[model samples]
Target chain A: MSYRAKVPKPTVKRLSLYLRELEHRVEQKQPTISSRQLGDALGLTDAQVRKDLAYFGQFGHPGIGYDVTNLVDRLRKILGTDRTWNTALIGAGNLGRALMAYGGWQQRGFDIVAVFDQNPDLVGQWLENHRIRPMSDLAMLVKERDIRLAMIAVPADRAQEVADRLIAAGVRGILNFAPRRLDVHQAVSISSVDLALSLEQLAFQVSLGLLGSLDEDDD
Target chain B: MSYRAKVPKPTVKRLSLYLRELEHRVEQKQPTISSRQLGDALGLTDAQVRKDLAYFGQFGHPGIGYDVTNLVDRLRKILGTDRTWNTALIGAGNLGRALMAYGGWQQRGFDIVAVFDQNPDLVGQWLENHRIRPMSDLAMLVKERDIRLAMIAVPADRAQEVADRLIAAGVRGILNFAPRRLDVHQAVSISSVDLALSLEQLAFQVSLGLLGSLDEDDD
Candidate 1:
């Protein structure tokens, strides 16, 4: 069977998590998994897992669930992570640096080909054999090295301006770690990864005396 | 009406973003906003914005959409961000330093109180107005300074251990920027701010060729 490209965004976000769970299950040598089992691993309900998978055609068994390896491949192809993604990290700060050193990127087939920082002292430095070049090199790096994915970790004030530069540098996709919202062009896609908001959210939940909301995600 | 301690998690997250947007609108002296206008500003559909607001009861009018100032005040009261959140940064690395200097936290009602790092060099060091303290002082500062929220910007290898210390020090909620997942007890809430997974999700959306799938909310 051929793959389709009309998967929903929510389904795709959940799919990456599903693939991670499936990879873990596959490592355990589990040949097959029920939607319930996969759901348990990724915090999705059995019905949601089954329903989400059904969007890409029937990929699971009626009672047995899904084949772990097969489903991983399907999600991989659908997510476009099946191919290696040459990513570039902007702002070699702690979060970006931590990410640059993370093992999970390689696990998911993403290569941090290059990184750029605006600091004069930090620029021309080395991060595990990868050079931290100046922001001025973004355009050159994007065109020369085929860097399509850019991660912005600069200060909030510079977030929008840096995004504009990345867009001009030919970055089609951006993962902004900066807290400020960037006004990227319509052609560019940006997702702001805010750590504080997530914390405030959990705090708000804790403050609300609503622990049961999370508990409801039981598979 | 007394504050309810059980707003939905997704609702709280959206409310956080809505409050920020509404604050801007109110500051601009926009007397009213329609559900469609709010949706347009936040990149959500009119129906979604309305449905989310409806969960908190009747906030928007049938014709006027919603009074920007009234809705902002209401959302603020609901999300508990009407007051400031004093947050502590664990690990004074590039990410933590970057975040402390980031300005959006104040815009969204999050304030950084202190920073902790195990590194001898970083500890007892000063970054701007904030001083970096040793890990041994976490419990003291958290108790004395009333720091309830923590942002973990440590390396993946040390994230879990740092989390244990933070939880023991009376940290109620955590926004984890580290790549690895940390396990915590039910009493302590932890939200993973994974940058790579976020990008992969975006790639999945772009691959699907569905713009609707990537529609983001302030949450």
Candidate 2:
């Protein structure tokens, strides 16, 4: 289990990109792909691609390169995407509704089993198939669905409180979209999808004329 | 401008956090703050805070630390958020709609001047006062509004095509929400916000029971 600690964060991120590329290759009926080809497609070096893959296990075929389908499966298991994860979503606002309508997560094996909102008017509203429940129902649903992962799309002011509730309800992983930072216990895992931060980073790069020359990390 | 090349990517990201923290500090009427206080709030070390701030200039006083408002202004200028950036949003789907409705970007200096979707039915529809334009109007709008940045929230298959159109329309930077990797020109900068990828990363950590012990990078 400590193996994940050994894998660098950037490597973990690149693994997701590699998995996406391999899946694309599979769709194109590409039986195999060389490290150079794989790396080139993702704007990475062949050595980096090889090294990242080698971290998990030895899968290189010496001359022929890696089997695209096999690598896809292995990467899936390594990233823990091979199985379905029942996830809870906090907030029923515009962003939360959009996330519910977003089919990408379900396709990637993360299913939003329940949605919660503090607004009384939105409590019974139906987003996709799940009825938007109030905050009080969060604990019940988390336990009922065995939900360990949660997504927070609440406003910045309410995000921390929502996170605390999710953690109290036994959620171990959180993907936060709010712009505020949350203080969590050491036993929890949280990743943020900060839209403004991403835009700011892009703005910095464009402002300084630092374009694609650098080896950018694609998180 | 070349100083950005010397500033590590992580440092650049940290700068954004520093700005956010400083802005928060300003609102709280805190005139000055030590590097340790700022770093503690952000889960970084005082040494890291000092080093990152030192990269741009000597903002710290020998005893008084840094002036909160002054540091915020400097960080804003350094990150290029001091001025407003007129941006375009391609694809008015669910996720795209969410971004359009999200007000965080505007507060951070990114203004979505135009919204575009290739769908004929949605072409004349309005999203937050800006009518959805077809791809044909992209070039004109880019010139008219001085848009150098764009956000692509289109389907994975259409992401590259939208990016190409944006680049052709003179977009120098892109924040892509698509799961696919885009091939942009060397002079253009691109950042991706992959929701599924973030969930996958969280899943991996939760699966390994690697909760919060590791020094997680907050991107």
Task: Report the Cα lDDT for candidate 1.
Answer: 0.74
> Which candidate leads the pack in DockQ?
2
Question: Candidate 1 residues A22-91, lDDT tens each?
Answer: 8888899999999888777677788888888888765787778788888877777876877877788888
Relative to the true structure, how large is the alpha-carbon lDDT of every model?
0.74, 0.82
- Once fitted onto the true fold, the runs of candidate 2 whose alpha carbons sit more than 4 angstroms away are A2-15, A18-78, A120-125, A213-215, B2-5, B25-38, B45-73, B213-219
Scored against the native two-chain complex, candidate 2 gets a DockQ of 0.44
Candidate 1: docking tier: acceptable
Per-residue lDDT, model 1, residue A175, is: 82
Worst lDDT run of 10 residues, candidate 1 chain A, spans A210-219
| Candidate 1 lDDT by residue in tens digits, B1-219 | 423443545565666667778888988999999988888887678887887788777467788779887787776676677788788888777677666766667766778889889999998889768888999988999999898788898888999899888888888778788888788866576677776788887666556654332536422
